[model samples]
Target: MIQQTLTQLRELRLSGMANSLLSQIEQPATYEGLSFEERLQLLTDSEANDRENRKQQRLLKAAKLKLSAHARDIDYQHPRGLKQSVMASLLQCHWINKAQNLLITGPCGSGKTYLACALGETACLQGYSVKYYRISRLMLALTQAKADGSYSKALQNLAKIDCLIIDDWGLEPLTAAQRNDLMEIMDDRHEETSTIIMSQLPTDQWYQSIGDNTLADAILDRLMHNAHRIKLKGESMRKIQSNLTDGEHLE
Candidate 1:
């Protein structure tokens, strides 16, 4: 009867319950102690938890973030313009719910990617889908997609992501074609989905980086006006890490 029940549970896709049932039957002494309601509760909770865990794993795999960082691991001690209070508010994820964009600006090695990844991970945990891309790489892929007749499909895919993290936003120069492509992407995501852009350049220089004055104006109007900004300051973290090899802490 137990073997038949385990097979039935597996057939019904109740993997969590099947495993729990096997464990319970293996230890009849313990199972005899729990009330019927407690046993049922355990099986139900196990199934629900397993399902949630699988969903989260799927989300994290799809995210493909540059850094494997979590919000709780954020370094507040580094005086790099990060504010724990602000981060705490952001962690509540209210801005994402409202479809607000985040702009993280800083010098090289200021941990922009780390912070962005942390937030992206948070979004994934909250059941929001996320995608990450470097602007240069994303643009190249877009150009390829256009040649293969999947340009529109690519944009549609980008539009569907709940959160898009564009790392190294201003690293590459934008051509006329790339500029238009960017406009389409931003236009689709505007006021509907959240985007986190990490750039080493100051926000003011972004206009110059993304040349074509008219296109720049339109793109910035969409991405900047309603965005929350974080400007990270301080020396390169790389420098600090390099000094740690001598076994002395950075002062």
Candidate 2:
């Protein structure tokens, strides 16, 4: 029995142990005392803990990025076949410090959202804390918070993130209160943290969309002053793909 245990331990790569009864082994080596089933359970528990540790490390790595995509993958040379210098310049990630915002304006079907999401994804990967919220969803969340008397906490939470990416900024009309809320959030983040505002409307029209001149001024002032504006060009990637594939592939 001792010889058999020693051989098994050797084969298992458990060093410094020979075949010893389960009762005689000390801790750890005692772990070797248990039956194969018990050992398997311990191994399984250890694997699970290792997996969780890896997952947590990945999450931590994603949160530290300030500018999500590094410059090379941005396709600056091609510009997706458009000749826009500004788009390339924005990829440098320098504007983040100027309390500058990113304003992405382009017609629907263009790569506006893709570009914005890519940038946000890059930021996450680079270890900068980022918060991604769709315009409609954010408004709904704020509305819910107001109803629940947690609006202050919600706004404070928004303020804490290092970078906030608001996708689809003008998909719906904003109420007076929502406008104020947005302005306040932007105001707090202005010149302090970085922001990415993705909108289909042109910069000139943002004022009309928001419906309050004072709030609009406050919002745009901070956004444009330090912002690295990128105006994407070309037909919507969606339409182009649909045309190529005859709409057979549904996204």
Candidate 3:
């Protein structure tokens, strides 16, 4: 009986050690020697870290669905850096009560899309919902929804997100019907939620691209009213990175 009791105690101690080792492997900063309070802190930290990583992964997946094709790897320290006002405005998005809009305009490869995605991800991280979609895909989706008699449901879903990013505006001229659908969305979201628009074309040319004088005026009025507008000016990061890689290979 004495031997059996000793064996049972030994098994229990070994099991405890195994569990501690598993915990350490899963969370490198935690260990068996920690005090009770320290252990609680470590657990909290582990959970928070897991949550943040998961959030970033989900946001990246949603951005991919919109064909963003880039990470929110914004370099705030560039020579021709983002304007201070723009950065401050983006950080203050949580305080915006009226569904204000943000517009980013630049030539090709000027980081317009990247900045917009980064801002949208910021809104997501701050506990607000976000949806990112390309302008072309948005129009096509509306067309299909109209055909299938699901247009109202689709619009409802779009309106629910806290922040919506419409990318690649002015890539192609919109038809009259397409313009009307876009106006409906903008009007619905104008006072209730925020929006981000990334376009390569200047604001003055939007009337020509959207194909409706009234919509062009109304949409621009809502979007520009107390809106934050940023203009990006820089060469294409892709081309620069490619050239750097080629130079390193030659060396």
Candidate 4:
């Protein structure tokens, strides 16, 4: 009878509850003292938690973040000008709810990508969909979509993501086509979704990098209008952690 009930639960797609039930059956003495209502509540909570975990895993896999980072693992001792208060607020993900943008600028190897990925992970945990891209790669994708006649569909899909993380921003000058593609993407996401931009250049220099004054203005207006900024300053974290640093020697 118990095996049949477990089979029924699995068929109904309640694996969490089924597993919980199996555990209870195997250790009857542990749960025998609990009231029926208490046991039922435990099964319900397990199923809900299991569903949430699966959803978060799907989101994280879809995100494809460059780094496997988490908010709890962020290095606050790196002297990179990151503020605990600001990060705490951001982790709550209220800005994402309001469709606000985030700009993270710093020198290369200063943990900008890590921080951005950490926030992206947080957004996933908070039940928001996220996507990460390097500026060059995203431009390549859009160009390919145009050639494949899926440009419109691609833009629509991008517009639906709750949080978009663009890493390596302003790394190269934009071509006219890339500029137009960026304009389309920004226009679609403007005021409707959140974007986190990681750049090595200062915000003021982004205009020059875009290469077209008019398009730069349009893109920046959409991206910066309601954006929060973080500027990190310090030596390269990679250099600091390298085994070949000045005093470190190989035996």
The top-ranked prediction according to TM-score is 4
Give me the candidate number with maximum lDDT.
4
Question: How many pairs in model 2 have backbone atoms within 3 A of each other, for residues 3 or more apart or on separate chains, i.e. clashes?
Answer: 15
Instruction: Write out the backbone clash pairs for model 4.
Output: none
Question: Roughly what TM-score does model 3 have, to 2 decimal places?
Answer: 0.72
lDDT of 2 by residue, 161-251 (tens): 7678787777788999899889879877877889888888888899888888888888878778877676766666666556556466667
Model 3 sits at a Cα RMSD from the real structure of 7.4
lDDT against the true structure, per candidate, is 0.91, 0.68, 0.73, 0.94
| Residue 186 C-alpha lDDT in model 1 | 96
The Cα RMSD in angstroms, rounded to one decimal, for candidate 4 relative to the true structure is 1.8
- Which regions of candidate 4 are displaced past 4 Å? 245-251
**Deviating ranges (above 4 Å) for candidate 3:** 1-72, 77-81, 95-97, 244-251
lDDT tens readout by residue for model 1, 1-251: 98999999999999989988888989899888899999999898888887888888899999999989988789899989899998998887888889899999999999999989999899888889999999998899999999999999999999989899999988888899999999999999999999999999999999999999999999999998889999999999878867456557556
lDDT per residue, candidate 4, 1-251, as tens digits? 99999999999999999999999999999999999999999999888998999999999999999999989999999898999999999999999999999999999999999999999999999899999999999999999999999999999999999999999999988889999999998999999999999999999999999999999999999999999999999999998978786666655
* Stretches > 4 Å off in candidate 1: 243-251
Using lDDT, rank the candidates from best to worst. 4, 1, 3, 2
C-alpha TM-scores of all predictions: 0.92, 0.66, 0.72, 0.95
Measured with C-alpha atoms, the lDDT of residue 64 in candidate 2 is: 39
